[model samples]
Target: MFSPKSVSAALATHFGNALVSPAPSPLTDEERRMFSRLKILLTEKEQGLIESEEEDEEALVQESGDSDSDYDAEEDEKPEQRSRKPWTKELCDKMLEFYRSKDLEDGRRGASQSFKRMQNRFRAHMKTEYDLTLLRKYEKTGVIPSVRYSAMRQLASDVRAKLGEKMKKGVPIHDTDIRKIALDLNKLNAASGNFKASATWVSKWKVHHRIVSRKVTKFVTRKATKDREKVLKQIDELRIKFLAVVRKNPGIVIINADQTGQVKEMHSTRTLAEEGSKDVVVEIESKSATTHSVTVLPTIYLDGRQHPIVYVHLGEPTGSLPAKKAVYGNKNLVIGASKSHIMNREAAARYFKEVLFVQPMPKHMLLLLDSWSLFLNHSFIQGLVPKGHKVTILNIPKGGTSLAQPLDLCYNQQWKCVMRRLNDAILVHDIDFVLHTRDNLLRCISQVYWAFGAPMFKEYRKYGWYRGGFLTTHPAPFVTPPKYMFGEGSEADCPCSEPGLIRCPYCKKAHCFSCFVINSHRCA
Candidate 1:
């Protein structure tokens, strides 16, 4: 409801509109855009006012016989929306074929065709395939918009010529590009086309744009996206910081630790890295039934064996930690579960104070942490640092955690796959122990991670750091998780010499389904 004077004054103050200000004769891009916006707003307001006032009253006016612009008349007067026509490779080629043939017939070299010819040829070509416009409409429907078809035909002809030149230049065309053109062309003398691009479509259509896309029918949803600039910047920053730390102290431990939420069931092979991100999407199942979760924090070193992993779940501790004594476990795991079942500030602080700081390690070390607020909070971490140790914290940039963190780079996906395989075994063999139970879940997570501390995984985990640009050379090769746990590569036999169903991660022994599941893989 702004008056013309008020709008002018606002534009003069904000956009420096030359009409209202004594700046200059010529306006800048901002001023021009503001003026254009003002014009559109004023025109829309005036038109709206007229429609509101005259909607109920119709004056007896004489017919001048000048209204043949898209004329259709019925009782309701609501014209059916036009169907969208995607320009496929074959269709585009056909259009160009007609253009070339017509050019040759006219003996015109590289000359644009006339609007009438173009319009007639396009109409005939569309009719041969399917004329969506000619479909029967409901009775009592009428075309409302008064647009000159001759003008629209001229514009379509111009667009066709422009696209033809692009085809000649060998630039690839996409349906989306054609859709944008179609939408823009329809805008002038426009008719709303039934092109539905919903948010659900965008979210589910998870293929990367460059990798290629698939369409369900004629709809073309845009491919999922990635922030390349952020990824590149994070990589560069990590490389610089890591090399600097290594140069300063050649023996500093480079550790990448990440806390991931493990679903109640591990049927889906999708890792936590791919959970929220649209990058590198693959369809997975068992993702929806996560009623309970366990937080698993794994610390992988760039050079040495990893420390015992910490498992956190959702509940208050029933017993207090003995202040003077250490918590003992044969599985070499540290377990805790706060009420939240997430890596909260208290859990982060506890991890440093117990599992990390107490581990036998060098005095100097470099730790890579994701930019979680609690991990970065000074008050939370200040008391957790050990007195004699030099812990340099490198904050992995936001959204760049996957690109920089060693656990996220590759190891975590493999870790989840192992967990999934475990779930599969339990389900297939009908194991007595319910992994859904908190204690059993903790035990399963511990056993998988404890196996990682073995000699085979020591060198295997270094590859993640190497891949993340921390290590100069690749580490020595090791067996993959699938081969080791599933006996995919080499043959393995149980004590009875029957074909082994699964391998015990801790005891380094193979067992049959009866022994693995029924006997709880008793290797201890």
Candidate 2:
């Protein structure tokens, strides 16, 4: 435990000459604040010392009070007899006049003009010459600085208000504008000259103040917007009319077709890395021209039916390609090739006649597609007229496929995502595997079709054709199809080996028609 002596020694060491000597007189504004705090500390610590000093003063005051109490009481009774003068309107007006005189000098409206000159003049004139106690007190009101500070603060606030207005108007505030604001603030404050208004500083300020700087992303042109609106309105009107026609026709079908490109090696969408590491390099398989791509055409019926995907590969189609005709009469998915690897008019016509037309053609069909030149020819339209099916080609708005076309918006993304995953898995598992090889490529494309099509059918059911009332049946050739079948029905029961004969439409599984009708819609 520390004795009182030790505590005193410690206090003495801390306070030093401040304890022994009196505080300096006529203190400046800052010093006066320190003096007041010191007085409080002394009052708490040295109460005994203060009582000793006040003893003589208290005795003298007591004696004087005995005689002067009655006189003082009388003076208090008449309040008007007070020595100090109260601040009258006349005195306030005089001080205002002095301030305004300087304020008006050279048209100085901003707070950058010094208020100290007027303050000093007011104090000197009132104290020495007039000898009038206008305020009747000697306390720091900080009136001049307070007024000037408010003015300076208003300048910054105005800047903020202007910035808010600009943002609301969608006018971007650049770095130069921020610098100008800072410069204005410096000018508004009489004391400060140099202010940091660097672009980095402005960025920090914006974030700290919760002022978001959002970049404007450009999308559709004005003309494109108008065209899209016009096209969509037309589609909506025609779709309603088409539904009315479909109510009478049971075999009517709504179909959407779009093409997507598949790359051999897909770049990683996301990857794992240590925090704060910058340069991350992930090595991929050896680059080849074949890694570029191949085109695929995916067709979907509103009844949630997806046709076998037609792959358009580079170079000529060879014997290595999957056979056109399976053991069954129906043709399999037509995998064709061209020099450019794109479906030309001939390929497009073949796809229409071979794969699409080979299926049971609906009585009245609506084919929703993008504005591809291959499907717009007179020959293509005339060919459909001869068939019992009335095929209507409704073109989706140009540059609006991503938004309007269900195939482009939904199936294409899902297809590519599945293909990417499969390709990545294959590359990771068997490093030597070449995806562009005939068998591997065929297998990969086939997996993309079947794997993506199953789950996709469910989504289409919920979102597409059935909801739109395009077809009466649920179109579950994949679901209701049988797993096994008797082949050419011989005495020795033989399972069907024909590819097209035993394929489920919904899930794309191998099942015969009898099993499909009996089991009916076996999902996945």
Candidate 3:
């Protein structure tokens, strides 16, 4: 048996050297017992280690050298013995023949899933063993030519013959017609395992010819000078009417209203002389500046008031929004901006809260506007109108705003006044701010006066007169000067001399003359 202090020191020397040594403590009863047990276990293990091998040093070295020699021999034999898979002509022919024999249930017989799987397997196997250079050479030399071409040849030729017959009958071959013909040929090839290459070539030729014909037609159809001017004038008139309506109804939102600002390039001539030339060579060069075009759409609310609702569209167009222009080019000429409807819907809600609903309420706001798709839809309008406010939407008849809206009549006058004011402001203040400020003020005043003043105030005044409401003999407080006198009687009639001759006190109607009162006494 070992002493506890000697055993602890020996254990520290063997195992605790790898770790930080703990502070020395005097052994209590439990600590003394645990240290005694650990000492016994350590002594037993140490005796076993001392009794074991220090005898096989030469044998271990000889065993490691033999293992290394065996590993080298295995490495040397691996390349020669490894199997290599090659894509031969036999594999390509077998795959092609299988597809040719198989009658696919689906119309897509040529590129069936089974056929694709086989093709993919072939490609993968080839890629693993062969270089891309070998594959390209095989494809070019027809050693492993794609069977898809041979399968499509006869059908292509048949389609070409049909198209040629149609052409001989004076039927113009359109791109769509050519595409349909090509598709038909492809389907035939899939079914019959053969298509003519000539059909593909003929279809392409027809498409090219059709495009050339269209270009020639477009060039020939250039409007005469007078007709062009007339069209331009019409466009100007439409623009003027459009602006007028927009001014009257600020609620009528037009996206991309700002014109594209592009400056024209200036061309100058320069003289050039060659060293051996008798006469100086003159070259005409014209540099045209690039002009960017922005598409502008004038939209109006079909209904004057916005509803309290919104709509979200998912997926492609159905019938909700119609195509504006005919598809003429290679790609679809989608006129409206991508996500414009979403943006416009957002703008409508913003404008309604920020501008329209900001005003004092209970007044019926009649918004006169056009019927553009963006505004005509109920979802957009619903989001615009505030709750509990009376919003009346008045949609102007299609193409009739010029004759109907007062703003149209007033635009030229307003524009002239604006231009004059701008000139005056520029001269007096030497600032452009005046023009914007004054123009905005004028437009605001004009719109307010025209829409509200004329229809509500002026019309109500006339209505009141017809209903025998209090007729003003003298200028009323609210009514402007040149006071409205609403009576059959003239100024010569005296109320005192002929009290009965005077009209009723309440409405001042001569029909109810018996109710006339002067100085708080009823007429007798």
Any runs in candidate 3 off by more than 4 Å, and if so which? Answer: 1-345, 411-416, 424-524
lDDT of 3 at 421: 23
- What is candidate 2's lDDT per residue for 1-524, written digit by digit as tens? 32343334334544564443432334455544555555555654443222111110000001111210111111111122222234445665566555445444577742321345544766533422122222222112412212222222333344555554443332333433444554445444432323334455455444433454433332222232436556667666656766665676677677787777766555334332223445434435546633545667878877565765554444434523335733111122467666556667767776777656665666677777777886656467558454566776666556556445766645665566544434443332223455555445555565446544565355443244443333445544332111111111111111342111223444445433223322232445
lDDT of 1 by residue, 54-147 (tens): 1111111222132223322111223245333434446555555554454555676655444455558777334321122221111113322122
TM-score between candidate 1 and the true structure = 0.49
Model 3, range 1-524, lDDT digits (tens) per residue?
43565446545755755334554445667656767667655565553311221210000001111211111111111122112244558765554544344555764445323435544656644332123323444545656533332223333344546654443332333333343455455553342322222334443433333222222211111212344444445544644565565567665432111111111111111112222444532221112221111111111122211221111111112423336743211110122222322335544444455434554543345444444455456456656677765554434344433333333322222223322322222222122322122123223223212222221123332222222111223212332111111122211124443212222322333321112211222221
Mark the 10 consecutive residues where model 2 has the least summed lDDT. 54-63
Cα RMSD to native, each candidate?
23.1, 38.0, 39.5
Cα lDDT for residue 320, candidate 3: 32
Task: For each candidate in the order shown, give its overall lDDT on alpha carbons.
Answer: 0.53, 0.46, 0.33
Best by TM-score: 1
Rank list by TM-score: 1, 2, 3
Q: Which stretches of model 2 miss by more than 4 angstroms?
A: 1-228, 231-241, 244-250, 289-292, 308-332, 384-386, 430-432, 460-524
Supply candidate 1's per-residue lDDT for 71.
22
